[model samples]
Every structure is written in structure tokens, then in C-alpha cells.
Target: MPHDVVIIGGGHNGLTAAAYLARAGLDVLLLERDDHLGGAAVSADAFEGVDARLSRYSYLVSLLPKRIIDDLGLDVRLVRRRYSSYTPDPVDPERGLLIDREAGAGPDSMGSLVAAFARVGAEGDADAWNDFYADTARLAETLFPTLTEPLPTRAEARALVGDDAVWASFIDEPLGRTIDARFTSDLVRGVVATDGLIGTFTDLDDPALDANRCFLYHVIGGGTGDWDVPIGGMGAVSGELTRAAREAGAELITGAEVLAVDPDGRVRYRLGEGEGEHEVTAGTLLSNVAPAVLDRLLAVGTADADARAASSAIAPRDQPPFSPDGPLDVPPVVRERLRQLAAPEGAQVKVNLLLTRLPRLRDASVAPEAAFAGTFHINELESQLSSAYATAARGGIPSPLPCEIYCHTLSDPSILSPELAASGAHTLTVFGLHVPHRLLERFSNDELRSQLQAAVLASLNSVLAEPIEQVIATDAAGRPCIETKTTLDLEEALRMPGGNIFHGPLSWPWAEDDASLASPAERWGVATRHPRILRCGSGAVRGGAVSGIGGHNAAMAVLEASVVA
Candidate 1:
């Protein structure tokens, strides 16, 4: 007999769906291409012989809802950063702006923000900053709660927001214009703009408004827009999900490469080395892979079916399971929608470094601990960021790379060993923006990685009292514990198309006014043209980052369909 549901890809999202479906008495089977679960969210000791478990690919959490955590009973703890961000002045390395959120609403706290703004020659930006975030906080409160429910119409959501001017600033117009009008300081403007560009390659004023969509997701997390560090690294988050799924009676299989997926709920896959291909059917199919990947699977399955119809001969042993070129056999509307999607391209460099100690800054007023505790910005003046984007768009590496650093150990040292913790060792994660995947056409991964690493270090050193290389810790291999991953590297490792971390471009959480919401899947924003299959990954509406919103919504759709039937 067919299983009730078969989830393709055992990432955190798949695990979430499995846990939920299994608990509801559905026979669920989850397949993971990798040997382990937790696709990008898993933490690993990135450097050999190092005891520190860095968040590896994805970092920080904001969009994950409290309801999912409570329902899963996850033991995850998120640490709210005391310092929001610290940006060193590009013109004067001796000065910087530090947002001390921990200072609270006291006069001293307000004065500290005002004084920091003045230090960077942004005299009146303090109030502007507060007002700007307060607007986002209101937006968050209005939209965050609806993430798990059936999709809301654009009109309904706009009505809920209840502010035409605020809505126009975020939804109708370009975010660049809003940033330009709100903040005076170049450094402050750049800091605010970075959120829209993280993992997305787009100009701030792009008429397409991709940046606006990206910006909306960034600031609407948990209604507070606060990105928190997961205690014990990201692994703990996935580990809990895996445990929950297993305990809930979900059957999970690793080292399973799904070769093809039929719209009729048939799935063909191969297990680990020396294992034969296997077939399974389910009443419902939940795809936890990217939308591009799902399209490929369906296309390959269609081709395989055609071949079987033409001849009865078995395929050659050495032949690849699927070819890259093919057209999907799904309904025309769905095929056209998939084809029209702009080819996804990631535009950032992720570097994980093990440091012996937090480096001191040229701005002596703030301690190294305080500056690095939250986001530490480097060479990211608004003008510099725009210049970097222009140069990168022309397929050249940005001069004086714009990057941000987060020291995870400061927030939660449990990711480190007792010896490393005692030795003042810290983990620094750097996200370098404006380096799009298209650059791979100009240079090899090794060449670009070497150049990007050098640029990042140089940028970091410009604001530091000493060179960052001086404090880098050596791994057990006796080599510098620094790892750089370009967009292509991410594509190869995580199966993320074009290395796009969101799996695809982000979408507005609510549906367009013209969108059809006739079915349970449609209302839940998890529907595919093929009724049997549904998306449960970042490609789903409101899906992205480390949040399990996609998985939660997909499971809800499946459950709702059953009830309707």
C-alpha cells in the first residue's frame, strides 16, 4: 500500500513536515540526498581539529515562529544581541556608530544613541532611526501572525497594516528612495540597506522591487525584526527537529538520491553505494527541495516514462539518472510560471574564521567585545556599497569589499570546547555582499576565493587596530582556520540553485488580489499545478532564511485538504 505522504529532501523543513504529518497519524517517509539531515541549517566544526561548531552555511534566526517551537517542543534558546550593530566610519577609522539596544529606554540609552549618531556626523539620525524601525515594528506586528495561516489577500493585508503612507514607503515605492529620505548619514543608510541585499543581488532602486520584497522579509520577523543567535549553534535547532520527527514515528532515510518524481505521486530514487533504485507511491508528495530542483525531477520523470513506453530494455548502468536539458510536462500555466522565473543567482561570499581573540578596533571608545558582539560593518558606506554593486554587476570584484561580521561565541560560547572557551577563542562569520554568482564565468572558484578573502581581510583591517590575520587561530591541521564559500561553492554543497540561499527569490507573504484561493493548497500558498505535489521549502510563499514557515504551511495545507475531503 502507498504511504500517506512522502517528503523529498530531509532538510529542516522536511523534518518539520514529517513530524507534523506523522503526529497526525499519517504514514510519512522522508528522503535526504545527503547522509545527514538539516540542509544549510546544520552546524559543523568547519575547521578540522577545531572544537568550535560554527553555524556553517546559514546564520541567525528571526522569522521562525514561537508556535512552531512550542508545537515541536524544541529545546532551542535564542539569545537577543545587546548591541544591534556597530559601523566604523569609513572616512575616519577612529570614529564609529554603535547601536546599544541593551541600554533600554532610559535617558542614558537615548543619549547614547544620539551621541553615537553625532560621533559619525549624523546629528539628527538618531530620531530618524528610531522612527524608521518603529514603522517596521508596526508592520511586523501586523503581518507576522498570519504567516502560518491561510494566505491573506493583498487588499486584506493592506487594510490590516492600516497606514497608506507607511505602506507606500515599503510596498509601492523603491526602498532606496525611502532610505535616502529617512537617514542622513551615509554609514547609517548603508547599514539599513544591507538587509535588502543579503543573499539577493539587486539595486536598491530597481523598479522590479525585488529589493523591496527582500527588505520586507528582513524586518518582519517575529513582529520585532530582531535576528537572534541560536544557542549551541544551529545544529541544536535541526537536531531537535530530527528527534521530534523520529519520536513522532516518521521514517527518515538518508543517502537517498531521488532521481525522478511523477505528478501522480510516484517517486523513483537510489540509496547509498551498491544499492538498487527503489520506487514508492504516496497519497500526497511534499517537495522540500528548491522549485528548480522539483521541476528537474518532474522533467526527468516525464522523459523516463516516455523511454519506457518506446522500449522494454533496461537503461545502461553507467548512464546518469537525469539530464540537465528537458521541458516539464506539467500543466502549461505552471510550466510557464516556472520558465518565467528569473534564473536565480546568489550574490554574497560566506567566510567562517576561527579567531584567537576578538580584534581591537581603531575606535577606542568602544571595546572589542562590544563592537563584535553584534553586527560589525566594514567599508559599507552608502556610496561604497553602491560602487561595489556597480563594479560587481560588471563582473569585477568590489574594491574595499562591503561585509559584516558576527562573533557567535560572544553570545553563546557553548559551541566551543572548554579549552577553546578558556583560551579566548571566538568564531567570526563574515558575509560579503555584491559578489554575484556570474563572476564565476570570469574567474575560477580558487582564484575568486583567494581574491575575496584578501579583500575581506583588508576591509576588516581598515577599521581594526591590527591586521585580522594576526589573530586567526590555527586548526589541528596547523593551517589558518579560515574557510571561504563562494556562490558556486554553496550551489555544489547545498544543492541551492545559483547558490541562492532563499532557494529562490522571496515572495510577498500574502497573495495578489487576482490570485485564486479556491483549494486548500492554494489558500495555503503551497500548491503546485499537480495537485498531488506541494512545495515545502524556501520557494514557498513567505519561505526563506532558517525559518520553518514553508514546512508548517505545507503540512497545514495537506491536513486541510484531508479535512475538506
Candidate 2:
């Protein structure tokens, strides 16, 4: 008998769907290609013999909803940092702008922030910053709640936003114009623009407004846009999801590589090495893989079906009954739709480093603890960011490469062993922007990794009192505890096409005005052309970052369809 639901790819999102569907009384089966769960969200010891469990790929948390945590009873703690962010002045290494999270809106509450902005020659930007974020906070409060629910129509979402000015600034026009109009300081503008550029390759002024979409996801997390540090790292988040899935009776199979998927809810896979192919059928199938990956699976399934049809060896009894309501074969329209999606190209360089101690900053006004506790921006002035993007688009690595660094241990030291913690060792995660995946074709992975690593350190050293290389901790094997993953590296390891973190370009959380929301899947924004198959990953609407909105919505869609049936 077919299971009620089958989930492909046991990432956090897949686990989320399994847990919810199983708890709702549906028989759920989840398959993962890797030996372990938590794709890109897992914590591991990147440094050989180091007693550190670094959140290897994706680090900080912001987008996950509390509803998911409470519903699943997940034992997770998200710690907000004291400092929101610190960006050193690109021209003056000794000065920086630091935004304190604890700073309120009252008089004298803005004193320290005002001075910091003044120090960076952004005297009036402190108020601008506050005004800008206040708008985002309102937007977050309005739209964040709609994420786990059905896809609201564009008109509905716009009306819910309520403020005409906020909608016009964020949703109607390019984000660049707003940034330019709101803040005068290039440094301040760049700090604001970073949100739009994170993991997204696009011009801020581009009419496509991809940057606007990226910016929306960034500031709307948790309704406050505070990116908190997860206690025990990202592994704890996935670990809790895994536990919930298992406790809810979701049968999870690791080391199961899915070879093909039929739209009629048939999945063929090989389990581990030396294993024969196994086939399973489900009433509903949820895809946690990238859309491109799903298309490949469908193509493979179609080819396999054709070869079987031409053969006389297979008996009719061996075949699963094809649903008359579903397509008899993988439709050409489905392939064309997937092809039309923007070719995902991740334009960031991720570097994980273990430091013996936090490096001192050139800006003496701010303490090292405060500077590194939150996001530390380097050479990311608005002018510099645009220049870098222009250079990168022309197929050359940007000089004075713009990057951001943050210390996980500063907020939560649980990731390190007690001895390392006592010895003042910390973990620094560096995310370098504007280094697109296409660069891999020009240089080998090793060559690019080396070049990028050097460029990253140089960028960091530019604003440091001392070189960061000196503070890099050594592992047991006498190797530096610095590891880097390029977009190409991410694609090879995580099966993300072009190593795009959002799986592909992110979509608006709501449905378009002309969209057909007739089906439960379409209403939830998880629909593909196939009725039984739905996206439950980053490719789904309101999907991106570490948020399980995709998984949550997909499960809700299935249950809704069941109710209708």
C-alpha cells in the first residue's frame, strides 16, 4: 500500500513537513541522500581534531517562526545579540558605526548611536537608520504572519501593508532609490544595501527588483528582523526538527539516493552502496530538492518508464496503478517552466574560521567584544559595493573584496569545548559578497578558494589593528582552522544548482494578481504543474533562509486538499 505522504530530501524543511503531516495522522516517509540529516544547517567539526562544532554552512537564524518551534515542541534557544551590527568607516579605519540592539528610541537612548554615526561622518544617519528600520519593522509585522498561511493576493497583501508610503518604497519601486533618498552617508547606504545583496546577485536599481525581494526576506524575519544566534549552533535547530519528525512517526531513511520521481507519486531510489533500486508510492509527494534537481528526476523517471514500456521482461503486475487524474507522462510544459526560472548563481564566498582570540579592531572607540559580537562590515561602502558588483558582472574579482564577519561564540559559546572557551577561542564566520559562481569556470576551485581566502583576510586586515591570520587557531594536525566554501563547492556538496542558497531566485510571499489560486497547492504557493507533487523547500513562496515556511505551507496544503477530498 502507498504511504499517505513521501518527502524527498530530509533537510530541516523536509523534516518539518514529515513531523506536521505525521502528527496530523498521515503516514509519512522521508528519504535523505546523505548519511546524516540537516542539509547545510548541520553543525560539524570543520577543523580536524578541533573541539569545535561549527555551523559549517548556514550559520545565523532569523526567518524560522515560533509557531513551528511551539507546534513541534522543539527544544531550541535563539539568543539575540547585544549589538545589531558594526561597520568600520571605509576611509577611516579608526572609526566605525555601531548599532546597539538595546538602544531605545527615547532621548539619550540615541546618544551613543548618534555619536557613532557622527564618528563615521554620518551625523544625520542615526535618525535615518531608525526611520528606515521602523518602516521595515512595520512591514515585517504586517507580512510575516501571512507567511505560514495561504498565499494572499497582491492586492490583499498591499492593503494589509496599509501604509501607502511603505508599500511604495518597498514593494512598488527599486530598493536602491529608497536607500539613496533616506540616508546621505555612503557607509550608511552600503550597510542598508547589504541586506539586498546577501546571496542575491543583482543591481540595487535594476528594474527586476530582485534586490528588493532579497531585502524583504532579510528584514522581515521574526517580525523584528533580528538575526539571533542559535544555542549549540544550527545543528540544534535541525536536531530538534529531526527528533520531532521521528517522534511523530515519520519514517526517515538516510543514505537513500532518489533516482527518479513520477508525478503520480512514485519514487524510485537506491539505498546505500551495493543495494538494489527500491520503489515506493505515495498519495502525495513533497520535494525538498531544488527545482532544477526535481526536473532532472522527472526526466529520468520518464526515460526509465519508456525503456520499461519497450521491454517484454516486466510484467503488468509489477506496475503501480497510474492515477487517471494525473498526467500519463512528464509533461513538456513542466520542463519548460523549470527552464524559464532564472539560472541560480550564488555570488558569495563563505569562510569559517576558528580564532585563538578575537582580533582587536582599528576602531578603538568600540570594544572588540562589541564590534565582533554582531555583524562586522568591511569595505562595504555603498560606492564600493556598486563598484564591486560592476567589476564582478564584468567577470573580475573585486579588489578590496567586500565581506562581513560575525562571532558566534560571542553570543553563544556552547559550540566550543569548555577548554577552548576558557582559552578564549572563538568562531568567526565570514561571508564575502559579489564573488559569483561563474568565476569557477575561469579558475579551478582550489585556485579560487586560495585567491578568495587571501582576499578575505586582506579585507578583514584592512580594518583590523592586527592581521587576522595571526589569530587563526591551529588544529591538532598543525593545520590552520580556516575553511572556505565557494558557490561551486556548495553545489557539489549540497546538490544546490549553482550553489544558490535560496535554491533559486526567491519569490514574493504572496500570489500575483493574475495567478490562479484555485488548487490547494497553488493557494499555498507550493504548487508545481503536477497535482500530487509540491515544493516544500526554499523554492516555495515565502521560502528562503532557514525558515520552514515552505515545509509548513506544503503540509497545510496537503491537509487542506485532504479535507476537500
Candidate 3:
């Protein structure tokens, strides 16, 4: 019997759609090219001979909705950190800024801001900080819940935000201007601007406001925009989604590469290391792969064949129905648009390390555990960040790499063995920004990897009492247990085009007033021109980060169409 739906990728979004559809009594089949389910959210033993399970690719959780967790009955725990971040001044290493949530403080309390600004000896800084975040807090509360629902019109979203000045700064003008106008300290401005450039490769003043779109998604997730650490590891999130889909009776196949997909729900695939091919059919197809990949598969299975046969002495009327000029469901123009969608280039590098002991900070007053427990910003001044972006834009690596470090073991030690935990073993994950994919293209992969590792260590050591290398743990063979991944590395490992973590630059979540159509499918933002096919991945609107919004929206679209029919 044909399945109700066949999903082409088994990433978190695909699993999410499978779970929901299967729970609704529809037969679902999920195919994955990788042996594992999670795409970039997996936790693995990154270092050789190291027992620690580090979040290798994408780390941290913020965009995931509580409604999805409840609806799917997912067993995942996200822990909020008491401290938010700590940034030390490169000029005066003895003083630093630390933002910590006071004990028993409410989520909306501005105590952390007030405290951190006061510590830095900046006059009127607390008030400025409060004034700046107050607007974002309102925007988060107003706009976040609407993400799970249908996309709102621009007028409707602006009305909900209720402040014309706030809207003008964020929506009309560049985010860099807003950051510079609102904050006095360069370090504080840099901290806020970093949110805009995560996984996005544009400068702060880009006219398109690509950086602003990225910033909005980062700050609006979970209705308050606070990023939380997943307990156990990032794998726990994927593990729960896998269990939910399995329990709901969704069939999942691993190591099965999908060769092509037909608009009529026909799927051709091959098993691992096998020469034989197999076919499956479904009532509808939900693609979790990137749009470019889907376009290539469809062209190979349909248009290329039609062109091949047309060159022969075949009558037009006798041609197969799958021809471009025949009764194809999706038009050739739409297919071309999908194929020509802009490819994303990742601008961040990830480094994972196993430390024998946390390094002592230049500011001796702050405890190492307190500073490293949350995001530790290193050499990321606003001027420095802008300089790095300008340098990378010109195809040059910045002299001093600007990066942020997070110590996962400090928050949850369950990932480490009892012996390692007792021996003060910790894990440090650093994310370096402005190191675009194009820069790595100039050098061999091995050379670039070595250069990035050295740059990260040098940056971190500049603000520390001792070089970070002194505290790095060694394997049995005396090799340092350190691992680094660049944009090129991620592309080869995860099949991410250009190594873009978000799949591509994010677009506005709503249809414009001048849009050609006003239907729910357009408002929902998941439909393709093909009637029986849909997108359920990061390419969809409001899709990015670790959120399963794409999958949830796609499932809703299918169910709504079924009811209407």
C-alpha cells in the first residue's frame, strides 16, 4: 500500500512532520542519507580517545517552541543559565563586564543589566541598557507566538509592536545604526550585534537588512529570546523527536539515499553500498532537504528525461506526461526560480576542546566557573567585529579572530565520566564569526583547519593569565584533544550548501500587501508550486535555528488541505 506521506530527509524537521502526521493516523515514511537522525544538532565524540560527547555542529537551544514539545510529548529538558555572558576588555584585562540573573529573579528583571553596567564603571549605562532591551522585550512578546500560527501581515505585526519609533529602527533602518545610537560602550554594542551575525555573512549596514532578519529570529525565540542549554546534550532533543515519530508508527530508514523525486509522489532510492534501486509511492511528498537539492532531483527525474526524448524522432503528442510542456503539475518557471534561489555561505567556525582545567581569567575577582559557565566573549569589540567583517568581505582573515566560548560541562556534567568530572575536566566550544566560507576556499582544507585552530587559541590566550594550550587535555598518545570545523568541513560532512547553518538568508515571515495571492497556503509559507509537494525544512519562512516550526507548519498545511477537500 502507498504511504500517506514520504519525507525525503530525516533531520529534526522531517521527524517532526512524521510524528504529527502519523499521530493523525496517516502512514509516513522518512528517509535519511546519514546514519543518524539529527543533521547539525547531534552530539558526538569529536576528539579522538576523548570520552566526552560534545555538540559538534549546532549547539544551544532557543527557538524550539513549548507547544511543539507538549503536542509531541517530547522528553527534552532545557536549562536556563543564571549568568548570561561575560566580556573582558582587551585594554584593561583586570576589569570585565558580567551579566548574571539574580537569585529568584523573574524573567523580565533587568537586574543583570544594571549590575553588569555598574561593574564596568560606566555612568548612566544601566539606564541605557534597560531602555534598549525594553523595546526588544516587547517585540519578542508580541511577535514570537505568531510564528507558530499563520504569517501576519506587515501592518498587523507593526500594530502588535505598537511603537512606531521601535518599528522604524528595527524594520526600516540598519541594525548597526540602531546598536550604535542606543549603546555607548563599544563592548556592549558588540555583544548585541553578535546576535545579528550568527550564521549570517552580511555586514551590519547591509541595505537588504539580512543581518537584521537574523537578529530578529535570534532574539524572538521562546517569546523572551533567552538561549538555553539542553540537558544531557544536543542529542537528547533529536532522540526525543525520533522516539515520538517511532511511537506514532512512522517508518524511518537510515543510510538510504534518495535518488530522485517525482511530482506525483514517486520516490527512487538506493540502499547503502548497494547497486540495486528501489521505488516507493506516497499520497503526498514532504521534502526536508534544501530547495536547491530538491530542484536538482526533480529536474533529473523529469525535465532532463523529457529533453533527451524530445531530441529523438518522437511526436509531441506521444511524449510522456512528465515533459515540461506536457501536463506537469509544477510550471517550468517556478522550478527555475527554486533552482536559482541564492545559495548560502556560512561565516562561522566551530572549535571543540577538552580541557584538563578551566584557565584562570585576567580579572581575578570573577570565578572561572561563573565566567565560563555562559557565553564568554573574546576580542569582540564593536569596532573589532566591524573590522573583521570588512576584512573577510575583502577575502582576508582578520588578524585577531573574534569568537565566543561556552563551557557545557560547567552547566551539566552528565556528559563527562565520573572520573573526568571529579578531576575538573571540562569542555569548551568556541564559535568564531566573520570567517566566511569564501576565505577558506583560498587554502587547502588541512591548512585552513590548522590556521583556524591557532587563531582561536591565540585570541583566547590574549585575555587569560596562562595560555589555553597549557590546560588542554591529552589523549593516551599525548595528542591534544582539540577539534575544529570550518565552513568547508561542515559542507562536506552535512551536505549543507556553502555550509550555511540556516540553509539560506531568512526572509520576512509575512506576504506583502502587493503579493499576487492572499490564500492560507501563501500565508502559511510552506507550499511549493507542485500541488502534492511541500517544504518542511529551514528554507521555509520562520525556519532557522533548532526550531521545528517548518515541520509543524507543513503538517498543518497538509491537514488543512485534507479537511478542505
Give model 1's TM-score versus the native structure: 0.95
lDDT of 2 by residue, 392-488 (tens): 9988899999999989999999999999999999999999999998887689999999999999999999999999889999999899999999998
TM accuracy, model 3: 0.92
Runs in model 2 lying further than 4 Å from the true structure: 105-107, 312-342
Writing each residue's lDDT as its tens digit, candidate 3 over 438-540 gives 7764788788888888999999998899999999999877899898998888888887777788877787766666664444456678877677888898888
Cα lDDT of candidate 3 equals: 0.83
RMSD of model 3 against the true structure = 4.5
Could you tell me every candidate's TM-score relative to the true structure?
0.95, 0.95, 0.92
Q: TM-score rank, highest first? A: 1, 2, 3
Candidates in descending lDDT order: 2, 1, 3
Candidate 3 local Cα displacement, residue 348, angstroms:
0.7
lDDT of each candidate versus the true structure: 0.90, 0.90, 0.83
lDDT of 1: 0.90
Specify the highest-lDDT model's number: 2
Candidate 1: residue pairs that collide: none
